[model samples]
Target: MTTTEHTPAPDAGIQTATGSHRKRLMVVLAIYATIIAAQIVGSLVTNSLALAAEAMHMAVDASGILIALIATILATRAASAKRSYGLMRAEIVAVLINCLLLFTLGGFILFEAVDRWFNPSDVAGGGVIVFAVVGLAGAATSLVILSRGAKESLNVKAAFLEVMSDGIGAAAIIVSGILNVTLGWNRGDALAAAAIGVIILPRAFLLLKQAINLIMQGVPAGIDLEEVRESIVDTEGVDEVHSLHVWGLTSGVSVMSAHIVPSAAATDAGEHPRILDELTMIMRERFGIEHCTFQFEEASHLGHEGLMHRDLAGLTSAPSVSGGQHVGHSH
Candidate 1:
């Protein structure tokens, strides 16, 4: 029914897909939870808006990493009829939720910080610096743990970046604490909070855009669709390629489908199988795209049925100039 280079064993496939990835998330969860808990207590004791904002940031990040862990665990489950991709998109969904949470809280913190700037509050400078130092140490340790796996997935990257920002927040609080002690500038705490918000909002929206693109089936980053099309078209025994679609199931896995019209002159018996093998190998080894579907067909079906590619715009396709074939369609 289908062709593949090799089928991995079930358990090994599961491990390769998500076992180690889940472990990566698991390894960082307790560390983040500890940081969140510590920051919450520190904020309460010091009455520092900057430290409070950092605590809120860590809370959102801890929840996001938990969701990523859950997604990876679900991904380890075998694929089924209803859930064909086996919950890989769950990581993207977690990323979407994470971004939304960050944006909402970041805005709230920004507003609060601005208000505090007009009417500064007295903060305990000694407690603020002590808490900031502890938070910095925690954030640094988390970063060290996550550095190896940060590039593994979008979900992991979001979590890792959140910690990185928290580290910056801690540094900001430390500076504010010093200013409060030496210069008697109580508004320094509010300034630190605003700085944290400014740093957070942009990164959150960027991750939000990436999540939307992946959900819309747009091509993943660092990949060129035209490059993929040209590679397939230039392959031996292939003619015109059409309806080529490329997207990711998750950050690390890409899937594609295309209709390949084979050259008639080279259409000997059992020839397409070899061509299919070559195509499969090309996608796997060349493009790092292992999950691909290529339908081999004759050129007569070029402008007919689903093989003509999809018309995404709300307009009828014009007839081809060569054959005057009408390409009217709707979705």
Candidate 2:
């Protein structure tokens, strides 16, 4: 019998940008699962609300990781007729879910902490110490994974952040445990749990805001509509830019549309292409925007001057005019 060896072709897309993220997410998920199991065991052994809360948070982190992994997989599919934008928005949806989970987890912790404060309970020092150490290790591992591929996708980054926060909460639990063990301060554990909630709330809020912005079709964080308009107006042949709109399809990807009036000379067919190219280049280079739609036109071609004049009267009395017919451009 002859022996044969099998070789598999590599996936270019995965190898280039997404493989590392998938690997990191899987590793982090496994680590978090272990941490959750340990926490559940430790919580029962110690009768500690802090440990239980941390365990619950770990559960949320695990779920978030799974969501991210699914989103990452879906995002790799090619755009189909039914879904023109492919699956990029899936990551945003995953991010939204993660943030909501964190927020809910934070709320639960806060409620439990308040209850514990009203009715204090003893926590086991040994169990706290062990669980805290496990948490720290998990956090450290998550940090390593996130640092390695943080730039790959926002979804992965969100999962990393959830894990990181859980790690910090674990550390706080350890500190509280040490205090309880040495000084017989039962309130410390409750306080530590509350601190965990505090840590999570801000991060959750930020993620929620970002998700909402993307869903609402709001401009990306770093981009200014006014600045974009200024850049267009500053171009050599562009007399003015108006009806400007900017929005994000997802993180780090922005789409913009605007109307521009070209100078009289730019109305010449030859000059129009040059003007369009310059504006497109400026948007790409200066603003880091790739998707753009621009309508080139003469001032007279715009909607009723009276309406535009009325709209701009308070903002600017003088309406800059230019000459050109409408020409649409997109990238």
Using lDDT as the measure, which candidate wins? 1
lDDT of 1 by residue, 81-135 (tens): 9987677677787788888889998999999999999999899988899888988
Please provide, for model 2 over 1-331, each residue's C-alpha lDDT reduced to its tens digit, 9 standing for 90 to 100: 1111211123333221333478888988888888899989999999888888888888987998898788777876777999976786787888888888988999999999999999998788777888889888988888887775666556666776787788789889989988988998989889988988888899888778878988999888778877787788878877766667788776656778776767777666547777777777778778867667787655654443555533532223333354223322311
- TM-score of structure candidate 2: 0.80
Q: 271, model 2: CA deviation in Å? A: 2.6
Model 2 weakest 10-residue run by lDDT: 1-10
Clashing pairs in 1: none
Q: lDDT value for candidate 2?
A: 0.75
Query: Which residue segments of model 1 deviate by more than 4 Å?
Result: 1-11, 14-19, 306-331
**Steric clashes per prediction:** 0, 1
Give per-residue lDDT, candidate 1, residue 98.
86
Q: After superposition, how far is residue 54 of candidate 2 from its true place, in Å?
A: 0.6
Model 2 steric clash pairs: 298-324
